[model samples]
Target: MTAGVLDEAIKKAAIAWISVGDGPAYALWCMPAESSILVVSGPGEQFAPGLAEAERATVRLRGDHGGLILVVDATVSRLTPGSDEWNELAPPLATKRLNASGTADELAARWAETGCAIVRLTPAAGSAVGAPDLPAESAAQPPRETPARVETRRPFRLHRVRKR
Candidate 1:
């Protein structure tokens, strides 16, 4: 990806309309620290079985013209700001944005309150792994940001996923 594209991706936390080749393809991605999710959309003929490993999962399309694959690697930590010791781990620009208008301690505290961590991903020079150019007409827009407001509410009823 170009520097411009990478900057956009990092700023938006997602990319769309990337072009890999002369095949119909598009991807939507979300990266929150150690976890990143990607959804690939393309014709079936372009699909291929993705590589699977101990820390990775690849789901491939299962029909004619279904050549698309969704490859997710658990080992690659998604880059996150204000978490996972980002000040020391992330690139300088990422650190600055994450810690913007706040002290390092303050940012760290915020991340802790949100139950988040930071992880780094390699092949990171560009924003994404593949370069599939998408047209503006087919791209997805980012969600609108909601203003923060304080509200009073009762505590949640207790539900346990596992008993100690």
Candidate 2:
């Protein structure tokens, strides 16, 4: 799916699941937490496929400690499976709509059809855990291009009177 499409999906899901405002369309990031998962959506190119594919289909997430897989649905205005967009929004996180109930499989299936995927986070096994850190990996990466700067020039220019 296209980055924009995936971003829209994430934003919608986040709004549905979490009580977050739809500030802008961007890539999504999440990490394990003590109680709930910490998620952050930002502007980015796309996600990883293996991540997206695994999330799209039903799959259990296992780690050294333990992990929870939340079924989520993310759809943008346009997203086609195996398209460039899909490739970009790879390695999608499995997130569920806030206050959603029912079986994980059911939720995942529903989301998958809409071009969204499931994300499973595995905690470090056998370790006493606290709150999970937010995933800032993407944040550290530089933008592909810098936005253009606007220049405000004076409406009129004054010539030197004495020089002439």
| Clashes, model 2 | 21
User: What digit string (tens of lDDT, one per residue) describes model 2 on residues 1-164?
Assistant: 22332233323332222211222223344433322233322122123334433222211122333332222232112234455543433323323333435454444444445555433322222322222432323323344444575667857757745765
Ten-residue segment with the worst summed lDDT in candidate 1? Answer: 45-54
Q: Each candidate's lDDT (Cα)?
A: 0.34, 0.32
Q: Using TM-score, give the best candidate's number.
A: 1
lDDT of 1 by residue, 1-164 (tens): 35443333333443322222232333333232323323222232112122111132321111123222122223333334544445544333233432145665554445445534333332233223323432224233565344665566978868856868
- lDDT of model 1 at residue 34? 27
For model 2, state the Cα shift of residue 84 in Å. Answer: 31
Off by over 4 Å in 1: 1-75, 78-87, 90-95, 98-101, 124-137, 141-164
- C-alpha lDDT of candidate 1 relative to the true structure: 0.34
Candidate 2, superposed: residue stretches over 4 Å from native: 1-48, 53-110, 126-139, 145-164
Task: Report the lDDT of model 1 for residue 30.
Answer: 28
